[model samples]
Target chain A: MPYVNVKITNEGATPTQKAEVIAGITELLQRVLGKNPATTVVVIEEVDTDNWGIGGEPVTLRRRRGL
Target chain B: MPYVNVKITNEGATPTQKAEVIAGITELLQRVLGKNPATTVVVIEEVDTDNWGIGGEPVTLRRRRGL
Candidate 1:
């Protein structure tokens, strides 16, 4: 089984966007890796800005600093 | 950087439990794979029962059937 986990910032993505992402990843894996969509698991996670870090600082701080 | 994604059924896991999971996975990767915890990313995604599937059936249906 092919498992794909996508992590994105929690910036108000809708359910339709999430569903599209799941379908796209599944299709990509099926076309390239020959994985079965039935067994392929795609999970989308939206991380809060404070929890996601970049360059030794949280995304929230980075955004505040205009980075 | 080692990125670890954990998927679990949405069964009311508390924030403390989630924190523990992140720490545990980071430590495990550091000990076993010599990965840097500073650069390691651990994300936890909890899937709803209706969205999660097993044996070609949704988890909600399976749970109802006592499977």
Candidate 2:
């Protein structure tokens, strides 16, 4: 059961962009990993600006604390 | 942007087993997808016996309905 869930947190991507991203990733997984596309469920979670991280640190916290 | 969220729902896995599964998948991604392991955020959410599906049907619902 190889269900790939994709979570994206960025301010510049719209719903269409999110859909396209998931579709592209799904295709990649199918082609590269030989995973069945039918069973692979790609979930795209669009996190707001308050819940994101980069470089082992939360983006919001880093911005708020100036770290 | 390439955060992989793995959600497993079954009655046959412990936390350490789940972690190993994630680690194995991460290695596969790094080797096959050419993704950087350092930046790859792999989240494993273990679900109880309620929220699982198979063959275009919910497992719990199917069990309850005897379908």
The alpha-carbon deviation from the true structure for residue B48 of candidate 1, after best TM-score superposition, in angstroms, is 1.0
For model 2, which pairs clash? Answer: none
Please compute DockQ, using alpha carbons, for every candidate against the native two-chain complex.
0.09, 0.23
Q: Per-residue CA lDDT of candidate 2, range A1-67, in tens?
A: 4466765555455566556655665565455445456766777665775667686777677667864
TM-score of chain A of each: 0.90, 0.63
In candidate 1, stretches whose alpha carbon ends up further than 4 angstroms from where it belongs are: A1-6, A11-45, A48-67
Query: Relative to the unseen true structure, what is the C-alpha lDDT of residue A57 in candidate 1, on a scale of 0 to 100?
Result: 39
Estimate TM-scores for all models.
Answer: 0.56, 0.47
lDDT of 2 at B18: 59
